[model samples]
Target: MDFLSTYKGGLLVISHDLPLLDESITSVLAVEHGTLEPFRGNYSYFLAERERRREQRIRERKHQDEKIARLEEGIRRFKGKTEKMAKRARSWETRVEKLKAQRTEISRRGRQVAVRFPQPPPSGRTPIKAQGLAKAFGQNVVFVDVDVDIDRGERMIIMGLNGAGKTTLLRILAGVEHADIGEVELGHQVSLGYYAQEHEQIRAGDSVLDHMRTVSALPDRELRSILGHFLLADKVDQDAGTLSGGEKTKLALAQVAVGAHNVLLLDEPTNNLDPQAKEALLDALEQYEGTLILVSHDTDFVEELAPDRAILMPDGATAYFDESMLDLVALA
Candidate 1:
C-alpha cells in the first residue's frame, strides 16, 4: 500500500525488498482481533511483536477451550430461556473472533518461516558447446568467430581488457542477450542462476519480508533467519528503497541460497561489498562444489576463485589458459 502511495517523480517511499526495506521503512503496522494498530519499530520489533501475538493466540485458545467445556455443562443443565446459553455463546464467539484475527494477522504480516530457493533441474556435466560465436555493432566487431566447450564442474573465467566482450559472451550464455552468430548448447540438466552487478532481477518497491515471500515459499521464521545472515534481521520491516549498495547486493545473494542449483553465473558479484564481506563470499565460493563462471574486476578474487584457468580476449581473438590470468596479461 505504501508503494502505491507516491509523491512526485518516481521516488518510492516503501518496499518489500529485503535490502531496500533495511534502507527505508521507519514504522510497522500490527493488527490484533479486528483492531488495527501501527508500530513505529524496525525489524527487531516486528519479530518480537509477532511472537507476542502468537503467544497471545495460544493463550486465547486455551481460554476458549476451557470456556467451551464449562458452557457445554451449563447448556446441558440449564434451559435456553435462562440466557446462560446465549451469554456463553456471545462470549465464546467474541473470543473466537479474536483468535481468527490472530491467524489472519500472522498470515498478513509477511512472516515466511521457511526460505527455499528454486532448484532448477541439475544441468549434469556432459559438456556445454559454444560453436562459432560472434557479434558486432555495424562494422565495429565486438567479437569474431569463437568456439569453446565448458566441461562439467568447470570453474571458468572470461578474462579480457575493458571493451573486449567478456560481458557480451556471458550475456549470450545466460540467455539475457543474444549473439548475432553461433550457438551455445548446454550439457544435460544444466541449471543456472546469474547475478549481475546491476541487480536487475529485483523489482522496485518491495520490502525485505515482501521480497522473501515473493521468491520464497518458506515460513516467516526461516525468512527472518536468512535475512539475518545478510544483516537485514534488524531491518526486515524497513523498505527496500532505503538500502545501501552493499546491503542490496547481500540481499540479492541471499535469494540464491534458498535453493540449490548447478551453475552459478556471476558478473562482478562483489561490486559494492566491503573487504570482510568479499572475503566471506570468497570463502563460500572456494567451498562451493559446483561450476562457476565469474566476471570480476577484483584481481585477487578472480585469481583465487578461477585460478589455473582463464580465457583472455583481445580484438577479435581469444586465448585460453590453463594458468593465471595475470601471468598471461604480464606476458602480453
Candidate 2:
C-alpha cells in the first residue's frame, strides 16, 4: 500500500482477488508484455482489459520479434563493447535487477492468503498403525490403550494444551522414543521426516547445504534446486549454528520438502514463522502428497488443511473424534 503513489503514477497490482483490488484501486493497467491496455475502472474492467491486451499482444509480438531480430543483428555486427553502449547496458541491467528484487518481494506476498488452495491427497494407503499402544511418564499416565491407524495422504492432527504429551506421541511415531506398552506398526515403504520444536536433531557445526547433502545424502546439484523452493538458496553457504530460529525451522522443513519422506511428523511447524511464513508452511502442507501427523495451535491452518482425524488429549483420557476448530473450541 505504501508503494502506491500519493500523486498520479498508476499502481500495478498483481493479485488473484478482484474484489480486494476493486475496493482499493480506481484504474487498472492490463499488460500481457508486448502491449498494454488501460482500463478506466477497477478489477472488473481489468478482466475485459486483459482480454483486449492479449489480442493486442498477439499483434504486437510480431513487430516486437522483428525489432529484436534487427537489434540482435546490430549486436552481432558491433562485435565488442563500446564505452557508451557498456554504460547504457549497465544502467539497464541495474534497473532490471531493482525491478526483479521488487517482483520477488511482491511474489512472496502473493503466496499469503486467507483462503487456501484445496490440494487433494491420494487414496486410502496406511502408513502407521498402532494397537494397544501405551505410554506413562513417572506416575502420570499419558494414555493406556491408544489404538490408531495413519494412512497415506491422511492428515492427522494431535492437539492438546501445554504439557499434554503431544511431543511424546510424535516421538513415539518417529521411532525417536520408545512407546512404553504396545505394538506399533510402520508400513514397509514409509520414510519418516521429522521437524522437532527443539531442532536438536540436525547437526549445528555444518553449513546448511552440507547438512542437507550429508543428512539426506543428496547430490550438490539436487541440493541447490531443492533448497531454492524453501527460500534457502542464498542461506545455503551460511552455517547452521548461525541461523535464527525461523531460519533453522525453514531449513528443517526444506530438508523434508526435498527428501523422500512419505510420513511427516511435525511438532509446532509454525512456531517460529511470521503470518506470511505461516501461510507458506500451510501451502507446503496442503500441496504435500504424504501422510501428515502434526501438532499445532493454529486454528486457521488446522481448518484449511482439515484433519481426517483429530486426537485430543486434555486432563487425562484420550478423546478420538472428528472435530473442526470451532467445534473443539466450543467443547473447550
Candidate 3:
C-alpha cells in the first residue's frame, strides 16, 4: 500500500483485501454485465454507489413491468372487438414489445453457500505429529527436517512461495503423497479429511451424489438437503469431471462435511471460489471444532482463521504465528 501510494504511475491491483483497496486505490473499475464501469473513489465509495445504481435499476424495472402489464391487459380487452379496436390493440402490443426489448434487468446478488462441517468424533489431545519430515522431487528438494505437532482443535497454516513445498507438505501429511523421509503420525481415534486443491480426491467417473455417498452413509433426503445448501442439488446426477471449477470445489467441501473428520488437511482450499463462496467457506471453517492444517495463499483467510502456529517451507521452520508472519502469508 505504501509503495502504491507513493508510485507516480497508473496501477491495477486485483485483490479482495478491503483495507488495501481502501488505503491504496483512488478509483475502482468494476466489471458489471461484461463491462468495466469506473467509480472515482475507493472500494467503500464504489460499493455505496453500486448499491444506489442497483436500487435505481430495480425501480425502473418495476415501473416497466407495470406498464407492460397494463399494455397486455389493453390488448386483451380490445382485440377482436372491432377493426379499429383491434388496430389500437396491435399498436399497444407493439409498444409493449419495444419496451420489453429495452428493459434492463436488475443485477442479482451472488449466491452464498451455507457450508457446515459435520461434528467430528472426539480425538486425542494431539491429533497429528510429524518428526523430521522431508521430501524431494528428483533434483529439487522442497523441504527437510520439519517437525510439528497439532493439538486437538488447533488451526495451523503452512506458508511459503509458489514452489515452497506448501502443497507437497500437505500431501505428505495427508498420505496422498509419500515423503522422501520421516513420517506423519496420527493420534488415537483421529478421522482425517483431506481437501486437495487439484480436486484429485474427486473421481472422474463418479457423480457428485455418488462421491458424497462414498464418504457418508447419510440418507438420500438428508444428503440432497446438504447439497442444496452448496447449490449442487440440481447437479447431483452430473458427472463430477464435467462440473465447473467452482462446482468441483463445492463438491470437495461437501465431501469434507460428510466425512465427520477430526483432523482436516486443506491444500489451497480457497482456490477457484468466488467472493461469496470464499466467505461461506471461511465462516464454516471459523465454526469448525476440528484440528485444521491448511495451505492458503489468501491472507484474509489466514487472518480470519487466526492460526496459532505457522510452518514455513523449504527450510521447514516452525514458529508461533504473529502479525509479522502475515507478510510471508501474503507472498504465499
Candidate 4:
C-alpha cells in the first residue's frame, strides 16, 4: 500500500479494497445502474458526494410527484364540465404523462442485499478432526505435523502470514486438497460446504440460474428467489463468466447457502465484497447454526465473527482466540 501510494506513475486500478483506493487513487468511476458516475476525488469523497446527490434527487422526485398529483386532480375536475374544459383536461393529461416520463431515476444499487443461511441440520459434537497433517510441493514444505479438532457449532479462524499455509491447511481440512500425510475424520451426520477463495465451484459456461440449479434441486421459482436475495435477480439468465469478481463471489456464497450443510469452510470469503455486501454476509454467518472454519485478512470481519479459537499456520499451533491475534491478521 505504501509503495503504490507513493509511486509516480499512471495506473488504472479495479479493486474492492477501500483503503487502497483512498491511499493510491485520486479519482473514482463508480458504476451504478450500468452507468459511470465519475468523481474527481478518492473513495471517501465519492461516498459523501453520492449520498448528497441521492438526497437531492429524492427531493426533486417528491416535488415532481406532487405537481403531477395536482395536475391530475385538475384533470379530474375538468373532465365532465364544458367541452372547452374537457379539451383542456386532455391537454393537462398529456403534460402529466410527459412529467412522469421525465421523473429522475434514482439508482436501486442502494437496496440492501439480503443474504440469509437457513438453519442446517445438527451435527455431532465434533464436526471434524485432523491428525498428523503435512503437505509440501517438491522441496517446498507448506506445513507439517498439523492437527485440528473443530466443534460442531464453533467459529474457528486460521491465521498466518502470506505463504504460511493458511489456505493450504483449510483446503486440506475441506478435503479439496490432499495433505501429504494426515488423517481427517468427520463426526456423525456432518455435511460440509466449502467456499473457495477463487470461486472454483461456479462454472464459466453456466448462467447464474444454472449454477444455482446445480447446488439444489429446488423448483426454478424458488432458486430464482434465492438468487434475488443476493441481488442477482436480473442476472439469472446472464452467463456467469461475464460477471464481475464481486458478483461471482456472491454466487459462490449463494450456492453454499442452498447446500444445507452443518459445517462451513470459508476461504477468504470476504474478498471482492463491497462494504454493504460484507455486512450482510457477516449478519447471515452470525445467525447460522453451523460450524464455521474461516480464512480471512479482514480484521473487522474477524472481530465480528468472534471465533472460539485460532490455528496459527506453518507450525500449526492452536490457541484460544484473543485481541492479540488480530495483529497477525493484518500481516496476512
Candidate 5:
C-alpha cells in the first residue's frame, strides 16, 4: 500500500484489504456482469455510489414493469371488442414493445456459497503439537527450531510476508511435506483437513463430484445438494483440472466441509474467492468448533476469526494475537 500510494501511475490492484482500499485507491473499476463500471473515489465512496445506482435502477425497473402490466391489461380487454378498440389496443402493444426495448436492466447481486462444515468428533485437549520443526529447500532455510501447540477448538493464525515460510510450515503440519529437523504430532482421535493454497489435494482427471465422494460417504443425492450450495452442482461432471481458480477453491472447501476433520489447516483459503464467498467462509469458520490453523493475508478475516495465538514465520516466534500485529498480517 505504501509503495502504491507514492507511485504516480495507473495501478490495477486486486485486494480485499479495507485499509489499503480506503487509503491508497483513488478510483475503483468494479467489474460486474461482464462490464467494468468506473467509480471516481476511494472504496467507501464507490460502495455508496454503487448502492445508489442499483436502487435507482430498481425503481426504474419497477415503474417500467407496472406500465407494461397496464398496457397488457388494456390489450386483453379491448382486443375483439370493436375495430376502434382493437386499433387502440394494437397501438398500446406497440408502445409496450418500445418501452421494453428502452427499459434499463437492473443488476442482480452475485450468488455466494452457503458453506457448512460437518460436525467433527471430539478430540483430545491438544489437537496438534509441533516441536523444533524446521524446513529447507536446498540452501534456503525456511524456518528452524519452531515450537507450537494448538489446543482443542483453538483458532490460530500464521503471519508472515511472502517467502517467510508460512505455507511451508502449514504443509509440514499437514504432513504433505516433511520438516527437515522436527515433527508434528496429532492428539488422540484427531482428524486433519488441510486446504492447500495451490489446490494440490485435488487430483487431475477427477470430476468435481468424484473428488467430493473420495472425502465423504454421503449419498449421491446429499453430495449433490452440498455441491449445489457451493455453486458446483452444474459443474459436477466437469474435470477438476479444468475448473477456474474460484471454482477450484470452492471445490476444495466443499471437500473440507464433508471430511468431518477435527483439525483444519487452511493456507490462504480466501484466495480466488470473491467477497461474498469470503464472507460465507468467515461465517462458517466463526461457527466451527474444531481447532483451526490458518495462513491468510486477509486482515478482516483474521480479525473476525479472532485467533487466540499467532505464529510468526521464518523465526517461528509465537505471540498472542493483538491489534498491533494487524499491519504484519496485511504484509503477509
Candidate 6:
C-alpha cells in the first residue's frame, strides 16, 4: 500500500483486499450489474455512497408506486359514473400509465455469494494418518519427520512462514503430490476433496461446465445448479482459463464441494475471495461435518474456523491450537 500510494504512475488496482484499497486508492471504478460507474473516493467511500444511492432510489420507487396505485383506485371508482366522471377516470389512467413508464429501476443491493458445502458421508474416527512424511526440492528441504493424525469431523490448520512447505504438505495429503519418504493412509469410508490455491486442477481450453463434469458425474442440469450457487451459472460456456482470480477461486471451491468427500485438504482457500464470499465460505465450513486440513495465510479465516489442532511446518510440530498460534498464522 505504501509503495502504491507513493508511485507516480497511473495506478489501476483490481483487488478484493479492502485494507489495501482503503490505504492506497484515491478513487473507485465499480462495475456493478453490467454497468461501469466511477466514484471519486476510496473503496469505503464508494460503499457508503453506493448504499445511499440505492436507498434514495428505493424511496423514490416506493413513492412512485403509491402514486400509481392511488390513480388506479380513482380510475376504478370514477369510470362507472357520468361522462365527465368517465373523462376524469381516463385522465387518471393516463397519469398512472405515464408514472409507471417514468419509474426508474432501483439498483439492487449486492447479493451475498452462496457457498454451502454438502454434508459428507460418515468416516471412521481417525480418518487420516500420515507417518514420517518428508519432502524437498533439490537442496532445499521443505520438512522432515512429519506425522499427522486427523480425526473425523476435526478441523486442523497448517501454519508456517512463506516457503515453509504448508502448501506442499497439503498437496501431499491430498495425494496430488508424493512425499519424499512417508505414507498417508485414509481410514474406512474416507474420501478426499482438495482445493488447490493455484487452481492447477482447472483445465485450460475447457468451458466452466466442462470442469464441473470432470469433478462430478452428476447430470448437466445438476452441475449447472451447483455452479449457480457459486455465481458461475452464467459463465458455464466461458473458458475456464479466462476467468478472473476470484472466479477461479470460486470454481476451485465449487469443485471441492461437489465431491461429497469426508475429508478436505484446502490450501489458501480464501485467497481471492471478496469479503462477503469469504464470510459465506467461513459459514459453510463451520457447518461442514467433515475432517479438514487447511493451509492458509488468511488470519481472520484461520481464527474463525477455529481448528481443533495445528501443525507447524518445517519442523512439523503438532500442538493443540491456542491463541498464541494465531501470531504464526498472521506471519504466514
Per-residue accuracy of model 3 over 110-191 as CA lDDT, tens digit each: 5569999877888999998989888888888888898878899998989889998888888888888888889889899999
- Model 4 lDDT per residue over 92-152, tens place: 9999999999999887656788999889989999999999999999999898899999888
lDDT of 2: 0.68
Best by lDDT: 4
Clashing pairs in 3: none
| Worst ten in a row by lDDT for model 6 | 104-113
TM-score of each model, in listed order: 0.58, 0.60, 0.78, 0.88, 0.90, 0.86
Q: Which stretches of candidate 6 lie over 4 Å from their true place?
A: 5-10, 67-101
Instruction: Please give, for residues 75-136, the per-residue lDDT of candidate 2 as tens digits.
Output: 45543588777666556555545544443111111223221222333334777888777788
Ranking by TM-score: 5, 4, 6, 3, 2, 1
How many clashes show up per model?
32, 0, 0, 0, 0, 0
Q: Over the full model, what C-alpha lDDT does candidate 5 score relative to the true structure?
A: 0.90
TM value for model 6: 0.86
Per-residue lDDT for 182 in model 1?
91
Q: lDDT tens string, model 6, 110-153?
A: 76789988998899999999999999899999899999998889
Global local distance difference test of model 6:
0.90
lDDT of each: 0.66, 0.68, 0.88, 0.91, 0.90, 0.90
User: Measured by TM-score, how close is model 4 to the native structure?
Assistant: 0.88
Q: Could you say which candidate leads in TM-score?
A: 5
Candidate 5 residues 191-285, lDDT tens each?
Answer: 99999999997888999999998998999898899999998989999999999888999999999988889999999999988778889999999
Per-residue accuracy of model 1 over 91-202 as CA lDDT, tens digit each: 6556655555544323343322222333345576654668788888789788877765676666777767777777788877888887899988888777676777687766
Q: Model 5 clash pairs?
A: none
